[model samples]
Target: MPEGPETHALADRLATLLVDERLTHVRFIDPGLQRRRALLERQRVLAVEARGKALLTAVAGGWTLYAHSHLFGFWRFVDDQDALPDGAPPRLVLATVRGVAALYAAPSISLWRTDELGAQPYLAKLGPDVLDPAVDARALLAHMRTPRFARRTLAVLLLDQGFAAGMGNYLRSEVLFQAKLSPHRALEDLATNERRRLANALLDVPRRAYRAKHDDALPPGKDYLARTRAQFGFEVFERKGDPCPRGDGRIVEDRLAGRRLYWCPGCQQ
Candidate 1:
């Protein structure tokens, strides 16, 4: 399944191709959405935004199209409708004069009144979007302090969408590794400084991923530690037995919350 950063990047690209451009055509394999296809055709795209792992496309009309590329869904971009990739029928398609965006295998597709989007179950349940520039460490720390999350192990809580909306398997492992907090550590057990460190890492790691995906070069005058850039290649994830960056021990892999994670017992403990 696509994580938050990947989905946000997809939104950025789709916005580049579709925003402000009128939809020359629209198609929906979903019978419910197909009836609403007329809502999109010939209407200008107001925006394409990512809410967690889902894409919400707003058109000139009152309609907002929502689609989540759950586990198997993926997107393809083509120069025009004639250039659309051949395969299984697309669950959704939004075509513009510049390009055509087709969503495939992504089963969740629906239309909604733009104002009522807050009622959508998935959007309503999401925690703060980590990639949103407005989200800061202090805010995340507050979320960490909530009892519903505070009582849980970082290993499991990190995977909970209500804890952090954009989080996924690879990101959970990387955030804990970057914070140098053992996955087994419970949120309430951390020292003051340790909690601060974890909060910063949660915001930093995912934003770095968004940057690496959009552009490797940092913005002018901003400086990031060398290791941060290095981690885009991955410090611990999928690198079992590799020497830890701290040079104290080898990285090890284990299952937590039924997903594989890698960490350095020497540094993380």
Candidate 2:
């Protein structure tokens, strides 16, 4: 799935290319959207913004192009007849006036009224986006402390967009592991310090992921994940069955919330 960082990166790139450009043409290749062609054609793009894992393209025509990659969807910008960038499969394509094309593939795509966007059932349902600078960590913490949220496991809660936006499977697993909270532990079962730690980690990880690329610069042969782990590489998540970076025990893998969660039980617990 394209997480918050990936989506934000796409929004940043697309914003640069599409913003202020008049739409020379708009094609609704998806059969489901063919009926809306009159509304989509020749609309100018005003801005592109991202909320959580969804992308919003504001059009001067008083509508917004809203899409979510859910799991396999993503977008690419090609200039002057350039080929689509190599990555996930594409399901939608939007070409612009500068001879640039904004390609969206394998992701759910939809168009809605700019005025009606806030009323969209899904947008209204989303929790605070972690990457949203306006998201108040303290406020979010207070919301989680409510009796209704107390019994939910941190792992499941993190994945719930209504709980906190911008967290996907990778962020959920990494945050819990970093905070040393068991996936099975409920929100109420966590100490105040633990909850704060988890929240802070959530804010930090996505920013780092957004700026850094996963590559060989990552420290070799270490298992312990610190705030510096991105610099050192990784603490857990994808390094399953490899040596524990913390030197406590080899990386252990288990299913939590129906998704694979990896950790050094000794280190994390």
Candidate 3:
């Protein structure tokens, strides 16, 4: 699944390419929104912004194009000379001055009133977006301390958009590994420092990813994983049965909240 960092990158790219450009055409292939013709056609793109893993393109008149690349969806910017890249043709395509911005295979795409967008059931339910530059860490900490989330497993809580938006399975595992927190740990069991560390990691990873792409350099390597791993990039998420990067013991695996969890049992606990 595309995570917050990936979505943020897409928003940045589209904002540069589409902002202020009149939308020459809007095509919607999804059956769910086939009837919204006037809503989808010939509007100027005012802005492109991201909320968690979702992308919103604000149109000149009054509508917003909301798309969530849940798991398999991806966007490609192709020049007129270029053909649509292989795989399924996009579900929606927006022609602009730069080229064609195609949204391929997205399961969720809709046209909505800009004023009513925040009140949508899905948007209303999401918690803070980690990739949001304005997210208040201290406020987030206060919210997590509330009774509603205190008893939940950290792994499960991370995946809940209502708890923290934009975290997918890979990020859930990677952030916990970075913080050295066990997936099974209860929210209430975390110390104040631990909570801050986890929150910082969530925000930091995405920013780093975006910078890594923009700068064209590899992102900073995880501290422990840099030394021992042969493959070179990953820290601990999928390195099960391999030597723990910390050398404390071999990597261990367990199931938590129905998703596979990986950690160095000695280093993490």
- Measured by TM-score, the strongest candidate is 1
Q: Cα lDDT of all candidates, in order?
A: 0.85, 0.72, 0.75
Question: Scored by Cα lDDT, where does model 1 land?
Answer: 0.85
Candidate 3 clash pair list: none
- Give the distance in Å from residue 23's predicted Cα in candidate 3 to where it truly belongs: 0.4
| TM-score, prediction 2 | 0.83
In the range 1-269, model 3's lDDT, one tens digit per residue, is 77776777788788877888887766778666666756756777888988878899998789998888887887878875256777666788887767888887745887889998997677888888876656756757866876889899887998888888877777777778777888889999998899988877776655555555455432222232222223214577788898877778877777777877777777775
Which ranges of candidate 2 are over 4 A from the true structure?
81-91, 102-105, 213-232
TM-score of each: 0.93, 0.83, 0.85
- The 10 consecutive residues of candidate 3 with the worst lDDT sum are 223-232
lDDT for residue 9 in candidate 3, whole number 0-100: 72
Q: What TM-score does candidate 1 get on C-alpha atoms?
A: 0.93
> What's model 1's lDDT at 122?
91
For residues 1-269, write the lDDT of model 1, one tens digit per residue. Answer: 77887888888889889999999989999787788788889999998888888899999888899999889998889998878766688888888889888988856888889999999999998888887666778888888777878779999988888888899999998999989999999888999899988888888888778778745554322243223442365799999999999999999999999999999999895
The residue pairs in collision within model 1 are 231-234
| Tens-digit lDDT string for candidate 2 (1-269) | 87787777677767767788876666656877867866756777888888988889898879998888776554556665457666643466666765555455566678899999998767888877876767656867776766867888876787888888788888776777667777777888888898888787777777667656433343222122233334424678888888876687777777777887777777765
How many clashing pairs in candidate 1?
1
In candidate 3, which residue ranges exceed 4 Å CA deviation?
A: 31-35, 85-89, 216-233
